[model samples]
Target: MSYSNAQELLSAIQPASGGTEIFDPATGELVGRVAQNSVADLDAAVSAARTAQPAWDALGHEERNRLLNLAADRIEANAEALAELLSREQGKPLNGPNARFEIGGCAAWLRAATAYEVEPEVVVDDGETYAAKHYRALGVVGAIGPWNWPMMISIWQLAPSLRMGNTVVMKPSEYTPLSVLALGHVLNEVLPADVLQVVAGGREVGEKLSGHPEINKIMFTGSTPTGKAIIRSSADTVKRLTLELGGNDAGIVMEDADPKAIAEDLFWGAFINTGQTCAALKRLYVPESIYTQVCQALTEVAAKMPMGVGLDENNVLGPLQNKAQYNIVADLVQGAVDSGATVLLGANPDSEAAGYFYPTTLVADIDPQNDLVTKEQFGPALPIVKVKNVEEAITHANSLETGLGASVWGSDREQALAVAARIQAGTVWINSHGTIDPRIPFGGAKQSGYGLEFGLDGLKALAQPQLIKG
Candidate 1:
């Protein structure tokens, strides 16, 4: 059945006895309901994946590559329709800087997965005794994706697992399940039955997946607290895990950087996905000399950008994905304001508005200890802090326990590169922030979580390495 929006998609599924309500953050309208899948359902999905995995692995890399490529083609064909539903449910604008961009990202990742080839590595060749290392598929992979960038992130998890010759049971976040469910439908058209499954529900379902004994590996993308819980729960079964968790990423602006030249890039780096992205620039550290100029430049650029519902073509930014997140952003910004931080733009949100809309906000002249600077707001609010020098900026940037990604901005390329190397993050950019590519590995450091995704490293993570000696 053709479904234009999330409500229609859910209606076609035949509502179960108990399900979680899904609402559009842009309009605060009930868009759909996702079945509250129980542990039994999780068991069934995992069991099915286990049964399917052996034969899938037997297909070998060549055949698997062919099928994955076909799936990518199908995804590209249906990209437009999927992008609209994603915009409606996920609250990213359909055009310009949003949903369509994510849809394209999904397709790009899938295509990249098809191109990656894994082969046996020769470890030693002493003539008398030769040794090699081969990668083999793990049984069943359980993937739990987050609300922000659901489609792309899900593809990141699923494509790699499938290409590595493993079966998957995935659960998209309760807040944005429709687009992923739709994606599952498209892939299943080309994939074998029970090879890929998408189960929708809330926290209980996720807990079940993480702890399930049958799941050989678990891949999750969400908050740091949740990642810790998963790590603890998976202890019994000891399932291999790959987590892309929370990041209070910091960006440093060197005194040599031109405020006007970098303002637009810097603004979007923080506010893209309404600042809901885990790797987005959350805390910006500017040199004391250029702090005011940097803030003014960013404020001017942000003021001109349109913010509204996702379906609007002209709107570049949309509402927070849910009310709880909206409140978090609002509360944190207020706390910063109360602490005497200067509000450069968008201090107020329309309380009477129909949606969970928080305007693109920028807070400046904030102390490092301020809650806004210390916490991960994960909404359209940024805290800009002044630093005495590059040494202070690096210190403040590395102060957070979570370090998924970071960035360094400066006109002096060599100096910026030197500073970028010192930042303690999984990924560090010299002139940009959170510029993820399909071919490069991405993950977290320290409390952010463990394991990597993307590139050969990601593929290897999905499989176990077997050493051969002859």
Candidate 2:
């Protein structure tokens, strides 16, 4: 069921009637059209999923795992086509850890869900009484995904739900629906009808899907504001939620760390996917002793990575996904410049350019309280703040209520580990940032949102616990 080209894949997901038109952010060229499904469409999808859950549950783990593995195989077979569509729609380079990487991650996560063990657990075994804990599927799940990594996040929401015997109805971001729709088509090649549905539309459809009474749980990944809105909408239904919201992740450079050695890792950490990642490093704190060296090294690395249209084989970074995002990035960087922050590499953008292309930018000596430092300006810009000591670094890092991820860089593992322990983020990386693995559990802390994703814990999030005593 794999397509030979992206156009063939696009044809598979196009709406019967004319729908919303999608354009490439890099070239402003039309990519394709996706069905702007309605509340009625979402309702019908939910109803179908509700009807299919029981029979899917009846097949049990063995049968379901088999199908999931088969779906992974199909994903691999169609990886090239899927990657092309993702690159065009999402504005990420095909060659870098962008489009292809995301597609690979989707398949890898599905296989991980199948391999994980979530069998019944024996709680107590006394001769007189025995108790066991079992997990049962929570009916239908509503998954709302973000635009940055649409396909991968959709799989993140759906894989565990299906593994736990729950059916899912997904709502993709209007900005990147074709990628999700294409992914859904590939997956459905192996999945049962109604077990998984992707309804692509606007704000109205998303609001209704969150509040729908039939859906037992909701999993979402996006901005903190939208996450809060969903929280309010789902209140009456009391729907279970797993939210991976906005992150202003920080990276700290210790005095003992070699600026040149860690610089490349640092650059990719902040600028990966052209700095569009939710958990990508946004704020960087460098000790005053090594601050100059660190900034220089990072600038050198950023200079080498070319930015252009996604299809180019040489470009490692692409344009902002859309004009609105481009404007946000532009405004924030301009504010920092106006506040007298020194531009280490790039702050100049061609406003008259044909595409939403902003150069990979690095701002140095910025105030700890600057809007660029405090806000989640998710783009290809990194603001470097010079700190007197690690204590000051930690204070500024933890100052923001949004703590999804953070990183501590140093030569000594023990010192890095000790510093990592104090960071308020959900997952703190030592010497690296935003390198997620399917085996490890990932989530957020404080206002960044809650509930874990990945590994065994993620499976439990989609199911209900039942205790039996004999």
Candidate 3:
């Protein structure tokens, strides 16, 4: 059923009392409270998942696919309500490529999972012997999601796991529990009891869930440090993990590329979701020959994009999800300013403002070693560094340890493809960045974490490969 407003959806989800209090990042008003689930709560959820998984898996792929498609239909039915709750809780505007886009993405991923073909593959059929590979359910999957794109990313983890015949126990970030809780409420309308569980909790619960012996695999999307921590916790149980961690994505603009032509795309590439996105371009390497032109074009486009509260239909961008994130963006931008970098636009925020609104900032003429360029300042601020040539641009782009995604922009497809090969990111785009497709496989390189998400391979990631030979 559809909800008329955020409150109606919030009431349907039945927010927990005497737990964690959630506030709107755009307005600093009380949104709701969620249960501060304990390690015991995680244990109960996992135990329940274990009890329900066999029956769910016994339903087999055909029935599972049908149920998942039904869940997707439910998501569409409640799309507006879900988007409204998501906008208020996550600080993403209802319009633009924010809340509504995310809601649509959730359904799209689910439908993609249903459309994917998964069956036993024949590896050999020689005269004397036969062999085939088959993928089986991995029991229970623990999906821990981050605040940014919480609902969509949770579905990215959940849909595949369920499609592969595994029950899911999800732990949403404490920052935006209501959004996930509300979304899960919608999905559970079609999902069988105990097949999917959303346990709203804190670090202890996450720690317990990661190390939980019953959890066969953990699908996590969040920070690098937290990913590392998950690695450590899972070591004891030897639990399989698909970690999509932090990214300091970089973008290169060729000297021959027209700045004005790519301005709007470049603007959204860096500032979409107010740049809180992990794959959003955080660093820009431009040829010095056209550095001024590129900066001016970006500034002109950035000036046109409106930023305000989430419910405002006119606004394309909104405030930071929380104060700590706002401060990190502020500190990184301040560090760049102290290094004598020129502020092309923004970087100034009123401390007295009610919400965590950091202006859409662009820094030019910044050193390659500056914190804003080297660190993952996941916010609306982008540091544009000028390079003498393409070689230097590629060098600076590949310098970071984290490489989730990167892009090379040029009119020449061959030249852009050549440059794209040198980057260390999992997905490298030519003339575009941060755009993802459900059919395409996505993962990371180096310390950006490992294992793939989306597409057929994503389904495989959540399943165990078994070989049948005779």
Measured against the true structure, the TM-scores of the candidates, in listed sequence, are 0.97, 0.99, 0.99
The residue-by-residue lDDT of candidate 1 on 242-312, one tens digit each, is: 99989999999999999999999898889898889999999999999998899999999999999999988
Q: Candidate 2, residues 1-470: lDDT per residue as tens digits?
A: 77998999999899776888999999999999887888998999999999999999999999999999999999999999999999999989998899999999999999999888888999999898899999999999999999999999999999999999999999999999999999999999999999999998889999999999999999999999999999999999999999999999999999999999999999999999999999999999999999999999999999999999999989889999988999999999999999999999888998788778999999998999999999998999999999999999999999999999999999999999999999999999999999999889999999999999999999999999999999
- Cα-based lDDT at residue 45, candidate 1: 87
* Segments of candidate 1 deviating more than 4 angstroms: 1-19
Rate residue 429 of model 1 by lDDT. Answer: 88
Number of backbone-clashing residue pairs for each candidate, in the order shown: 0, 0, 0
In model 3, how large is the Cα lDDT of residue 14?
61
Residues 310-335, model 3: lDDT tens digits = 99999989999988999899999999
Question: Over 4 Å off in model 3, which ranges?
Answer: none
In TM-score terms, candidate 1 sits at 0.97
The residue pairs in collision within model 1 are none
